[model samples]
Target: MKVYDVEGFPNPARVRIALAEKGATDKVEFIPVDVMGGEHRTDAFKAKNPDAVVPCLELDDGSHISQCTAITEYIDGTFDGPLLTGKTPQERARISMMNLRAESGLLNAVGDYFHHATPGLGPDLETDQCAEWGNKRKDVATRTMAYLDSVLDENDFLAGDTFSMADITAFAGLAFADFAQIDIPANLTNLSAWRAKVSARPSVSG
Candidate 1:
């Protein structure tokens, strides 16, 4: 299998962390994509992933998978590791719910703030921006942080007691929040402590 992505980017980092947790990091070839140069928008690259995004997965059978959630699902199913998705229907539904909340409410929100409100990747790549919408999304990110903090107050992880893909998504979201200069509120102590604990995991610390 192969993964096309730029290292250190938020979405890509989520997949990388999932692979590391699965002990499958060494099993796949990593192909670096020149996203900053607009290579991802080219016809050739878009053929593999219509979304024109990074961290796309190419299977051994010549099929391709796009989007972090889909790629992580593939990884969790194929690799032998702790269940990152879930084992039961209830667990799966809960993890999926939390994962979506983290992706849309936090990660994507921070991304909008970075690309639209700020200079982002420069005028060349960020051709269109809406500061008003971006600022609004920034507020959404903050509120999601508080929501996750409250969730953490009741459980060790976002979905429940076990470490899962929801935790991975939220962790990467917070990392992006830092890069975008979006402050995690000082009063979100549960969120802060949860971040500290997740950071210590071998999957993230490495």
Candidate 2:
């Protein structure tokens, strides 16, 4: 498999982390797609993924898979290792719920603030920015931190006691938030501890 992504980007980082958890990082070839240089907007890349997003997986047979969650599902299912996606139906539903929550409330919120409020990528890429809407999304992202803190207070992980995809999404979201200069409130101690534990994993550090 060929993995196309830009290093340090949030969505790509999520897929990389998933691949690491699946023990399949060494099995695939990493191809750099220069989003900063508008390489993703090229005809070649658009053919592979019509949406023109990175972290796309190209199979040996020439099939392409995009979207972070779909790519993660493929990785977890095809590889033999620790399962990031849940094994049971109930676990899958719970993980999916929390994962979507993290995606929308944290990750997407930061992305909106970055693209709409700040000079994201550049003027060429970030058109139609509205500071008012961007500020609203920033506020949403901040409130999400508190909600996640409460969730973490009850359980060790986002979905439950075990480390799962939801936790991975939250981790990636927080990393994006940090990059966007959004600070996590200091009062959220449970969320802080959970982050510390997840960050210590070799998947993130290595």
List runs of model 2 lying over 4 Å from the truth: none
Candidate 1: stretches off by over 4 Å: none
Local distance difference test values of all predictions, in order: 0.97, 0.92
Q: Give the range of the ten consecutive residues with the poorest summed lDDT in model 1.
A: 121-130
Give all TM-scores, in the order shown: 0.99, 0.98
Model 1's alpha-carbon lDDT is 0.97
RMSD of each: 0.5, 0.8
Query: How badly does each model clash, as a count of residue pairs?
Result: 0, 0
**In model 1, what lDDT does residue 195 have?**
98
**Local accuracy of candidate 2 as per-residue lDDT tens digits, 1-206:** 99999889999999999989888899999999888788899999999999998889999999999999899999999999887889899999999999999999999999999999899778988878998888899999999999999999899899988898888889999998998999999999988999999999989998
Show the colliding residue pairs in model 1.
Answer: none
Q: Model 2 scores what on Cα lDDT?
A: 0.92
